[model samples]
Target: MTTRNVRFVGGPLDGRVQDLRDHEAVAGRLLKHIHLHDGPKIETQYELHYTPENGWVYFLCGTQP
Candidate 1:
C-alpha cells in the first residue's frame, strides 16, 4: 500500500502529521479523528476533509460526551 505524508490544519489536530493512504486520499473525503482531552476529559470530533492543496482541513462536527 502506498501512503502520502499529509498535514492536518485547524482545531486540536492542527500541525499534526499523518499518513494518508492512496485509497483514502480523495478530495472531500471525510476522516474521523478523536481527540481525548487529558485535563477536562472531553472528546472532540474533527471531521477532516481532504483537499489537493491543503491536505487535510479540520471541520468541527461537534463534541462527544
Candidate 2:
C-alpha cells in the first residue's frame, strides 16, 4: 500500500515526520505514542488535524496513566 509522510507537531514528537498508510493519513486520526524516558509506563496521545499552513498537526491529547 502506498504511504504518505505525516508531520507531527507539539509534544515530544514535534518536528518528526513519519510515513503512514494513505488511508490512515486522514485528519482527526488519533495516535497513541508511548515514551520511555527514565522508565516505562509513560504514554501520550496525539490527534491529527489538518491545516493549510502546517498540514497535518498532531496536538497533545494529554498523558495517560
Question: What TM-score quantifies how close candidate 2 is to the native fold?
Answer: 0.75
Query: Candidate 1, residue 8: CA error in Å?
Result: 0.5
Candidate 1 residue 38 Cα shift, in angstroms, is 2.8
Tens digit per residue, CA lDDT, model 2, 1-65: 98767777677888899887778867888899988778777788999887788766678888888
TM-score of each: 0.57, 0.75
Model 2 lDDT, residue 10, Cα = 73
Best by lDDT: 2
Model 1 residue 1 CA deviation (Å) reads: 2.3
Q: Which residue runs does candidate 2 get wrong by more than 4 Å?
A: none
